[model samples]
Target chain A: MEQTTIRFTLNDRPITHAAMPYRTLLEVLRDDLGLTGSKEGCGTGDCGACTLLLDGKPVTSCLVLAAEADGRKVTTVEGLAKDGKLTPVQVAFIRYGGLQCGICTSGFIVAAHALLESNKTPSEADVRAAIGGNLCRCTGYDKIVRAILAAAYDEGELVDESASMPVMEKPLFTEGPM
Target chain B: MRSFKYYAATSWEDAVAMLSKNAAAQVIAGGSDLLGWIKDDLNGPGAPRADLLIDIRTIPNTSYVKFDAAGGLKLGALTPLVTVAESADVLKNYPGLAKSALSPASPAIRNVGSIAGNLMQRPRCWYLRGKDFACYKKGGDFCFAVTGENQYHAILEGELCYIVHPSDTAPALIALNASAKVVGPGGAKDVALDKFFIGPRTNVLKETVLEHNELLAEISVPAPAANWKSAFIKVTQRDVYDFAVVSVAVAGQIEGGVWKDGRVVLGGVAPTPYRATAAEDALKGQKIDEKSARNAGDLTLVKARPMSQNAYKVDIAKNLIARAVLSLASA
Candidate 1:
């Protein structure tokens, strides 16, 4: 097999590796670099479980050859966090129950993060279209939609101060109500 | 996948020379389709494995979409499909082409798939792609679709093989009067997009007229008329990540609510993009209305020969043709 030395940036770190011509980026990331967060649901591009950010755009790593990643920057699901803090999309996934079985969570989070970076306030249709490539058999996409919508709002915006008090202390009904 | 030597061609001349020297080499652009085929082991028995893969994605100056008054639109072969789908010029002038680019597959595939690679990709017929069946397209004696499962087979031009052309952009380009610039050892030549594809009868082994060493360098679409309007409608099983069951591309001039000089091309129904000449003629000089659109659509598939399992495609093709033409006319 023919081997070539390729240099690129992986998760903000510059790295070099020897790769065969036929190896895909998915293999290099999972087997060679130990960045296995990007799972491979389908070897084809139909299932976007292996989605990653290549130069700030989401693409199927399974469809992309490792040679094509030479001299490029790759951001996997593992690189989405910074300073030990979870990204908004990740936090929203937990609060809104955006994942079940967890196999498709990484791809969905990465795709949603890319969407939020480009458009902070995306409509329901826009969110659906943005993640149209991804498949989640467990969640049925309702929670995923809610999670993305919640992620769009600021953390302070989601808190309701009026609802913080106990229900028994508040009036059962308004004065004007029958 | 089989082991192969990879070469990144820096220039057009270098790429052509490398291709001419190695008979077993294949040029790869996006590798969106090629890699899947390679993994599926579609290269049948006795067929030499692709010994070399010439990576053309790194070639500079060959990944642009330029538009000029004289040239209309010139798209480098290595230009990604997403670029074409998102280009403002394409969306404004050639809306059908833009819609075609955005209609098929998912965003991930469109992000990396090249326009030229989409045009040159092979059929998606199950029999031809499967390992067990050595159908006619794979140089076998019989076409399994003639008696086997063929819901997605061609309905118009199927003789030796029943594989449908699996390209959404080819019909749109043909409707827009496009041509491909090809380079090889003999030099460069411009071939019209209409003539680019070859039927199964012409050569069962290949879908296009491109020789082993020839490379599709760029695609050029002529400028449209002053009142040009276009639309593309694809009928698929699902909303996303599915190939067209039957797609229609319509481009023409609508002057004062009257349609003229129309071009209609149907995909996923023939070995090549089927140009509905009779339908185009029927649509010419007709007033923009649903009735006229229906008549034109009926005329388009007057001579369609549908297989046993794919008869529904004729109706789908007709409906899409009418819908596309009417929508473009009203736009």
Candidate 2:
């Protein structure tokens, strides 16, 4: 069997990996690349633990073959935090207590990141629909929804305020929308 | 996973050639189901290995859905589940089909998994999906689902195989009377959705009419009639990506509040998508009032021979058909 050599961009860096024909992207991410953020809760696509972004679209990495990802851009939770800074959604997750055991955190964060990227002002229902696939055993999803909403508000403000204030470290303006 | 030869098809021609060369080869676009089969060792012990896997996700045209001059819908086999669910054209013309596509696996899965893969998904029978007892669906001597833990087993079409067809989109397509275009070594051919399924009696080893190395290229559905009204209703334990305990998809023309030329199909209760001709007949020339809908739903389950543990499915099936009918009636 000839190994399929796949070259793709991961975490804003180009990388090449050799894998068997049927090897899933989850295997390539966790086994070959040692990026354990994407977990495989269920080998089938039911569980959201293996969620990642392929070309800016959220998809179950466990279902996507690594060979299919050749020359395509792949984004994992590791890619969300740029320049050693937590993504807005991640910060909100920590601040709002979005998770408990954190087994499903990476997948949730990935889903949330996708939501915030597309929609700046996502309603609670929108947030719910975005992360509907992710199941959390401990938190009961209240904090997760709050975190996503808060992140959306923060993202909306950041986009608006960042234009005025050059190089401001803190994103949240306390005096803005409550 | 056992070692298997692999080929990444750079083009559709290359993919067809690869499949033509190896009869034992399996096409892997999204590894969603195939990976689980390998990880669980669902294939029988000492089974003939699949020595070749052709990756078709790289084929550009195979991943797009196009509108035709005939006002029909064309779905490339590799079109992702999310695309099918969210396509405006699909939602407008085939809401039932789109809703089935949106049955909600994890967001990530919907994003990458193909609609063709969903219809081609292996049975979800725990016995079949699990490594435990080799059920009859897997060419075993006895069906473990028949007498043991048969809660999720099929209610109808259980004589030959107790396995339920896993695709949520399949029942909707069956209701729409869709056709699948198959491309293989022999060339292209179209098959009706109903005739596409092969029962266990025909070949215990195969699930669909697709021959070895035959690739499902496209699925085409006719445009909805001017008076067409349709709905897909699924009863599941959860709101998310769970398979329906029982589901119904109905499409028909409702004129002056009377259903005519209707097609009703049930899912999750049979080996193939169960078409309720009796129910269709009952509603064909009748107005879809609550009384008539309930009566028609009663006819839907007339032929249902549910197993002892799956008797609840009969009631659920009835309610699903009723609900789908009422929804379509209101539309």
Candidate 3:
């Protein structure tokens, strides 16, 4: 049960942590490094909610040991944007209603980003195959697939107005005594 | 998961030495299969714990897919399944291998699952996998699948245990006449893929013939003949990301549009990848037609002894064998 120091690049920054040998990359990222973008729907590899880029390829971080990422580059969902500007996939998700409830949003964005980076013009089948590992319960995947296709075809300009509705000012439980 | 000491082996010799010295240690390359077993606690509470894990993924020269005139097609033990499925040489020469590699699990799992790890994966029998049941595979007195749910149990070769080998690529490898290069403290040795798998009668505790101290170094597949055609067909409950209920792989040389010689291997049917030698013999001099393909299918399943609930698998296996052979014949 000894802890070992592992040095790896995370979110474009170098990080070193003393972690147990059995600690998964998902655990180290969420617990140790405070990068909780990647969610663990299933600790096993069945659910791809823990998907992240390991040296540019998407893999379930929950199944990957932290030590395996030593000296390697890992990119989580938080690393998708730069300088406060969202990536095309992220913007398209907002413009196309790619998510609901938002539990599996980060994984979908990361996976779609990796796919678009490799394939500029992914067909509907290609997009489906790319995100085949990721599972989303609420959105039913239609909006998510369309969002990715929109991003691939640079059609983010056709924004869905309901996706960015303004928040109300008043709180629902105003001054109610408990 | 239980804690274990981890060592990143830099060379093949060091990895083998580590395994040889520690009998309870296990090698982790890709770790897709081992981690799942560890999480599920398949090793019983009283069983010996895995004290050491030799991480061999860092070792150089152990992750390449090379093809040469002397070696034919060599896949390093650590080569990823996706790499094997996507390799141009593998796709062109050994389409059955490509199909098998691509058939298992999903894209993400294939991205990290190693070829050796796939071959070494344990059976997916729920009775053996779950902690509640004590099947014969876990050293119990009886196998629950014999009279239990028995739907997914083996039908062809279920003497003591009915656990089917869960690997998709293994059948294709066997049909292609591949050999595994194993290294241990003694030295290196080559084992045929057909003989690599050990049945429950041979050793009820393990799957492959790999000793605890040995490491599968590489898998080398013989080059197909000039007119060789190959195909793999798998029937699964779900279209994607599910294990095969019945799978068949066919590889043979077709001369003048007639079948000459070939190997037909069935997966998800028995303890090992079941090679249909009788079916192969049936197709030796026959033309690749519907009648001949159906005859090969019938001959393949002639000896299948189906369980109470798994009688349907026999028919499924036969149909898959026919479809696989017919596809190869027309290729």
lDDT leader: 1
- Model 2 regions more than 4 Å off: A156-178, B10-13, B45-49
lDDT of 2 by residue, B237-318 (tens): 8876678888889998999889988789988988777888888889988998898889888987888888869899999888
Clashing pairs in 2: A59-B108, A60-B108, A60-B109
Model 1's CAPRI class is medium
Q: Where does candidate 1 clash, by residue pair? A: none
Ranking by lDDT: 1, 3, 2
Give candidates' CA RMSD values in order. Answer: 4.6, 4.2, 5.6
| Per-residue error (Å), model 1, residue A97 | 1.0
- Residue range B184-268, candidate 1, lDDT tens digits: 8888999999999999899888889998889999999998779988888899998777898998898998898888687899999
The sequence of per-residue lDDT tens digits that candidate 3 reaches over residues B127-197 is: 87787786776667788887789998898877888989999999999999999999988899999999999
Q: TM-score per candidate, in order?
A: 0.94, 0.91, 0.94
Q: For all candidates, state DockQ relative to the true structure.
A: 0.61, 0.55, 0.57
Q: Write the per-residue lDDT of candidate 1 for residues A1-178, one digit (tens) a residue.
A: 7688889999999989999978899999999999999999988888899999998888999988899999999999999988666777787777667898999899999889888888978998889988999999999898888778778875443332332422223222234321
